[model samples]
Target: MSLVLAGTVAGLVLGDAWLWVAVEWSPPAYAGFYASGGFDTPTTVALLVAAPVKAALLWLILRAPAPGPLDRRARALRRLLYLAVAHALVLWYPIALLPDVVGAVFQLALWSAIDVLYLLVIRWRSRMLRAAAGVAFAVELAGTADEVLDELDLPELGSSEVAAAVLMLGGAAAIIITLVGQRRDGRWSRGTQAAGWLSVGVYALVIPFGVFFEGIPGGGPVLPVVMGVMALVGTVWLAATARELPVEDRPADPPPARRRVTRVAVAAVAMLPVIALIHPEQTPHLTHTGWSPACYDRPGFGDLKPAERDAAFLCRARSTDGGVPPMFPDGLSDQEVLAYGRVLCRAKDHDEQEAVLTRAGSARAAWGADPWDLVYVCPEIVGAAHPELLRSAAETEAANDAHIAEMNAECRDPWPRTKGVVQATARYFLFADGDHGYLVHDPGDESAEGEMDQAIDELYDDGDALVGAVGSTVLVGHVEDVTDLCLTVKAFRTAPPRRLAGWDQVTEVPVVSRSGRLTVPELDGGDAGAGAPMPNLAIAGKGRYRLRVHVRVGDAGEEHLVVVFPGASRKRLELKS
Candidate 1:
């Protein structure tokens, strides 16, 4: 039993290491999804692997012999491990299958209570603590069968829910049996206690590996083979070492003073890293080379500034009016611009406060009413600013027109012009923001110009002009062109002709349009709820899209359109009266 526990702990630690290796070597391949947006395979795998590893290690250590004086300690450790495993498994399994956020919170709270009870029991043996632990474990077991039964979509019998329930219940039963057996024997060995402590160490080591490797890239395709190999090797190594280990015995009666001190020290050390990990003050470093000056104004932004000031530049600007102007014109040099911009942005100017930023340019461009920038800046503006202009209709038609034009001008064969054009548009949106910019080609291609790049030069000159006008940090030239491109070629729209029960039905509604334009006449029912057919649209542009629904729902509810896209998906817009 002691050897098994030790092996389990060792396996967990090794598994974690293997997981980390997997993440570093092989990332998941997600087709049709943006690289920036996808599931984290490594992290999931790590968490899954860590849980079992921890349980096994704890079980093995408790089975090991304890020094003469602290025989009860072995029993206490065993009980704690058993309770923890049961609580964690019950909560984790149900949450994974059903994924109810509120229910998960409740389960976490229950688990926390169990932990507290376990700690109290170890402090002083009371019938109440033992009862609490038993009740907690029992509740976990009872809930398991029902939760497993409810997961109808699960494939294979005795897998997923059944498998999970068996492991947890079996572990719990084993602990109870072991406790009864130990009481009959009247002797605890030091080997058993060592095995338990070793298990914890193994668990700690395995966690990082599992998180980094197995999960992120996923155990799909050929990765499972790698995982199996790692698990086997880890298990074998641990088993071999655990068998020959020696047990140390302590005095039959140790003063209570020393035991208390040791427990306190262990607890304090364990909490140090956890505290650091969750500290509210810790700020993550930003990896992106290009973040808008506006981001600097965000709280904790100063923590991320590069150490070498010379490597970066800051641009500062401010609008005299509370309203943001279309452009800022200040010809401050690049260095001066970055310094000032940083200050202004940090100030969080509402009206006349100076905006500051750090960048490679002299000043930042204020994004005006351009649809693309509006989508980037205050997305609500797209719907609020222009009532007559249908952004989706105009954008889609423009893209179609652009595609046709490009095909005629470049491809001439009409073979695969759309793909190339679409690719070009994607690239443009990906890298369009900030000072070091590229120009949109005739067919919507973005080519980085060398020292003599005409587009970059033009943008730089135009940006300088705008910065001179507006004092705000972060300025750009020719936002109108970008907005025009997004509206015309990249936006797709679909709307229901009549009220529907759900969004799924809306996808089936044919987007019937005359001259590629949709019109919604004021109809009965509140502006947002069951009324006239809405014009639903999807924008394929690389950046964000904003929808403006036009109508009034009175006090009941306003009509709105749900827009889903790549980043920042699913926004609901109320129809303006």
Candidate 2:
């Protein structure tokens, strides 16, 4: 019990620590997904509850009275144990939202099948736990596969259907094997044993899978691999100890309750209150108020007096327009809009001002069409103090244009500025930049020379290369080329050359030196001399951005992308070249 408690605490702490470390070490390409927070109080609650509940369930099963004629108690206890382990694991797991409710449903279905199999065929509780844990590993593999498919631009293949199908096939195969084994011998068949061993192998395989596909889940490699290692260890322990350490003899009487079982039961009972004490009722944090421009026509606004209606209009307009980046008509200047805004601000009664503005709008709408956004009598708000209110309509239009431009220049829209990915068209290139920049090679415009520098620079630091707040460590120069070379963009893996939206473009760019046409396309085409930066290298930000072109090393099958940081010593510089 003491060992279990200590290990549980250690596991929790280590899991949390590793989560943070993974977040820290994750590549820039995958960092966007993790920019939001991770495991919350719910995960902690789940973890705290899982172990005790499992122990309690196990104790109950151990204490159940034996069956009179048939092994009914054993069968019942097997079912209970299966339910316990499966529920515990499911509760402990933090499900991702992308797959939504389907993920949970699939998890339930897959784990339940494993549970049923253990209940029907497997006699040893150890094998049952191991098999259930193996299913968990399989689920992780399915999840990783989905992520990999998404990255590869095969989104259709990455759907929940694929994951569910894979899990179902695996589950069905295991079940069929178990059934076949049951027919061969009442004790258990070779097929069942084979399946159990195969499960162990599958569970063990996840550690390597996590290592290889660390960048796939955006959750980093450490956590998944650690989880796999733990699962494998548990599986092995259970399998080895099952026969030697059977819980009790399957006899007519209930087994004597051992001190360990009693202790486990007491601990489980105690955990309920602790869980209740620590349980959190999550209250959503309201970030902003939702207001719409078209709310005036809704139920509440009807039947108001003209003055009140104007006030309502003003309220709605101000709620939507205030604090937002000012964008007046083309002719309006920022100074003029500010001046008008200041005039509007002078009105002591907002409702009265709204009424006046409404009337003005009505008159304009009746006589000639006026833009809804154009505050027609804006200057008139201060007509008593300033004679400029009597200015010609043409002057007002010009002022409005000037106001808009000036406001836009001064006030940056937070959404665009803070967004992780800035999707924009530059020449024919569909360029998106966050922590790293990605350039889709749409070469409608032959000279992409100076077009992408600003977008590229925004993602990376000036001079030597330091990635921006929302930039990938490795900037993808071009995704569409012959090789499906995987490059690390900071902590994430980005492979390219798949189809994207918009015009088709040439993958390779012609290179020109002091001498005309230095290298022919085919003769020196493949990742040779540093031609126009293809999506061929990891970004090395040394004060400036440098592309580390990966070249084949000797005649070996394996290849490594050279690490090039600009302004480094000759060794690094030569590597960059």
User: What is the TM-score of each predicted model, taking all chains together?
Assistant: 0.25, 0.22
Which stretches of candidate 1 lie above 4 Å from their native place?
1-127, 139-190, 194-269, 275-577
- The candidate 1 region of ten consecutive residues with least summed lDDT is 466-475
Runs of candidate 2 exceeding 4 Å displacement: 1-443, 451-577
Model 2 earns a TM-score of: 0.22
> For model 1, what is the alpha-carbon lDDT of residue 544?
32
What global local distance difference test value does model 2 have?
Answer: 0.35
Residue 539, candidate 1: how far off, in angstroms? 38
Candidate 1, residue 546: the lDDT equals 32
Candidate 1, 118-226: lDDT as tens digits? 3343322455645655654554544443344444344433445566545445424423433333233333333333233333333333444443343233333234423
Candidate 2 residue lDDT tens string, 1-577: 3433455566566765443332222233332343335456644444455445434333432333323333554445445444444433343334443455555455445445544544454443456545654564455445545545554466633355555556535543543444333333344323223334434444434534443344333443334333433343333222222221223332232244543464454355335334534423453211111132233342232234434433332333333244542122212322343334444445466564454444433222222212221223342444445544444446655675564344324322212322211111111112123113233222232443554555476434544332221111223333233222222211112222222222122121111111111111110223221212233222221122222333222222212222222222212222221
